[model samples]
Target: MTVREDVHSAGIPVLCQSCEARHRGVCGALDPDQLVALAKTSSKHRVEPGIELIGDAETVDSYSNVLSGVVKLTKSLSDGRQQIVGLQFAPDFLGRPFKVESAINAEAATAVSLCSFPKAAIERLMKESPELEHRLLKQTLNELDEARDWMLTLGRKTAAEKVTSFLLMIARNIDPTVNPTAKSATFDLPLTRADIADFLGLTIETVSRQLTRLRMDGVIRIENNRHLTIDSLSRLERRSGA
Candidate 1:
């Protein structure tokens, strides 16, 4: 039989067969036997919004794969102030490998689903699997690129552009299938206006005003203050100055 057939015949674990992580996450690097080994020790769970998944400087014992929903990463100041530093979506690996302690706080921004495994399992697997390490490195580099892009957004973009860019970023990342040419998209506003204001370095009022403007201009539709639909992604992109 062919290699593809051989891999399939090896039998993927039931828990991993349908997992996005198996198809697109770091777990994709693992073969069926390796997957079975990982799945044997992994557990799936959900976290409610506002729940802390990991705290800044906390000892790292385990790692997770984001199964669904958004995770908000933050950094805290000595004065107890916090800044939303990044966001994680489904299929994203949820920890820094090789780090003994976490440097940032990770919280469930929305209702989040996760598949967790002990840190030792992943670290051991990484030592045996170069593909696994490569996948992790690729994700880290992608995050670095995103950080640079966000720096541009925060530092140089106008307030209106920042808001539009935020929406565009969410649209693209929340669903990996979303492309620049997509006609439309829909999703909930995962972060509250106040939280979004903090993330964008704007006031809550400004966020509200921008949403109102987008809705008025037929760029998007809002319902119940949370659910939103992009009426025209191209127009939204233009508004974002991208």
Candidate 2:
């Protein structure tokens, strides 16, 4: 792996000091001096789609914050069946704190950028900063809530409902800064058809068919295979059974 070290005249990485996620991410728990110390030990890397950042059952050596793009977490069965269990977006912290090994595989779902820190550095900070610990706890609880919601969707929702629910999730969470009152939003789909199928427990053809149906119904407009515009988020939410 190639590592890039970008430092400013002040001896801190410009990327770190100017990070858009600074106030919203784990770094928000740190002070300026702490950020500098952490930045000194960190590296920013641009990773390709499909790059596995961590493997199931692998020893955890570091932590990362997604700077951009999406990451999918997956688990595999002994029989070779695999399912995408979760997705992580920008500013989301990676790795399980207090655990030395991972239970799921984390891979880039698109071209991604991340700021990574060694586990030792993060542990040291957490021990010294109660705010950091609190931040992690809050994030864990949010993930738990999402997991429960997804469970309900998977267990009881119809295929069309499941697909709309997934799209609604993307719209609501993809950009934290998006205006809540905005009637429409446009963005690229982060997952491939096959990945979406695995995540939704459907076949790839079903995923595509549902998307087409949604387009025809005027809930969304597919600009291409990857780009889409939600014509009316309200209508989409109703279709999602929300």
Those runs of model 2 whose alpha carbons end farther than 4 Å from true positions after fitting are 1-3, 7-13
* Top model number, lDDT: 1
**What would the per-residue lDDT of candidate 2 be over residues 1-242, giving only the tens digit for each residue?**
43555432355456766675677888889887778888878888888888999998999999998888889899989898888999998789999987889999999988878888899999999998999999999999999999999999999999999999999988876765678688898889989999898899999999999999998888898876889899789999999976
> How would you encode candidate 1's per-residue C-alpha lDDT over 197-225 as one tens digit per residue?
99999999999999999899889899999
| Runs off by more than 4 Å, candidate 1 | 1-11, 176-181
**TM-scores, one per candidate:** 0.93, 0.93
The number of clashing residue pairs in each candidate reads: 0, 0
lDDT of each: 0.88, 0.87
